[model samples]
Target: MSFIELVGLHKSYGRHTVLQGIDLQVQRHQVVTLIGASGSGKSTLLRCLNALEPIDAGEIRLDGDVVSGPGVDVNRLRRRVGMVFQSFNLFPHMTVLDNIALGPIRLLGAEPRTARDRARSLLERVNLAHRADYYPDQLSGGQQQRVAIVRTLAMDPDAVLLDEITSALDPELVAEVLNIVRELAADGMTMMLATHEMHFAREVSDLVVFLEQGQLLEQGPPEQVFGDPVEPRTREFLRQIVEAGRL
Candidate 1:
């Protein structure tokens, strides 16, 4: 079975449907990118994968275990399936090191020293170890976002869901953050990301899935999806991205 599976997924907010019978599969150690225009349900799909938002219909299975629906242990689920948001959701009161260590210490019951050590190691890998003592407010947006990704990594999740993690960064800062993602992909992390960075997506993703109006329009290898998409809608989206100089 795939490491992650979304089958006939459906979700809604009030009367507006955000996902429509979506189906997807992600293998272990693969990097999958979700691309499309704004409000295309990319973010919502990531949220549903991590169970931050419950599905109104269908199932999300992780390694053959159902992760969706009521009675599931979401707290435990999050430990295995971590997520990073665009806003860099670090604790304001915590230092960079503390922010990253908190999840492992609190959720995984690691010794505080052990958690902090792991956090520092991850920070060093991302070239942020020097900023360990700084608060999120004291760091640049890229640094803060890097801390957010490190925090997720500290938990040692089986898979990660990144929700447009560079959207809130300055243009100069975006590359610094994406570099970390590139490294993660190289290290064989199982990741699913929602991104508008078309070039980066094409370069790093094993598979690219496109969504439009809450529907998954097309999905395939990056070359097929980006080089010669079969869907007309996919072609138009790429055309717009190319015109914007984003692809």
Candidate 2:
């Protein structure tokens, strides 16, 4: 069975429909990149996957379990999914160690010492062991974002949703976060990323999904989507992004 599945998913904010009939399947160990212009529903799609935003219609399943159906246990479903955002939402007053440890301690009922240990290991994974005692304001934007990634991973989730995690960083800093993601991909982490970095998406993702106006336009292997796009809309979108130096 696929690791993550979304069938006919629909979402809206009163009158504004953000996603319509979205269907996707992410196999275990696969990296799928969702790319589109702003307001195209990429981020909304990611948010709905984790139940951060409720869907108006359709179903989301993870590990063969229905997570979005009526009466589902949302908390139980969320434990297996983790999300990282563009803002690097770390607590300003907390040290990096505590920032990473908070979720495990609160949500998973981990002991303080055990959570601290797991936080340290995750920090090491992101190569931020030396910054564990530093506060968010003390580190560069890149470092803080790495901390955010580790913070999410400390939960040991089965799937990670990256919502343009590098979008808020300096141009030079973007590489640092993308490198960590590349490493995770190499290690077979199952991930779904909403990204503007076309080059990295082509290099790191197993599949590329193009969304336009809250609908799926095209999806396929990275080569087919990025190298030889079949749809006119995909080609036009790629051309614009490439010319803007965002690809």
> How do the residues 1-247 of candidate 2 rate in per-residue lDDT, one tens digit apiece?
9999999999989999999999999999999999988999999999999888989889999988889967988887777889999999999989999998998899999999999998998888888999999999999999999999998889888889999998899999999999999998999999999998889999999999999999999999999998899999999999998889877
For candidate 1, write residues 1-247 as lDDT tens digits. Answer: 9999999999999999999999999999999999999999999999999888989999999999999998999998998999999998889999999998888888889999999999889999999989999998999999999999999999999989999999998899999999999999999999999999999999999999999999999999999999999999999999999999998
After superposition, which runs of candidate 2 have C-alpha atoms over 4 Å from their true positions? Answer: none
What TM-score does candidate 1 reach? 0.99
Question: lDDT scores for all predictions?
Answer: 0.94, 0.93
lDDT of 1 at 173: 97
Q: In the order shown, what is each candidate's alpha-carbon RMSD?
A: 0.7, 1.1
Question: How well does each candidate superpose onto the true structure, as a TM-score?
Answer: 0.99, 0.97
For model 2, which pairs clash? none
**Residue-level lDDT for 111 in candidate 2:** 100
In candidate 1, the residue pairs with backbone N, CA or C atoms under 3 Å apart (3 or more residues apart, or in different chains) clash, namely: none
Q: Cα deviation in Å at residue 232, candidate 1? A: 1.0
Error of 1 at 137 (Å): 0.9
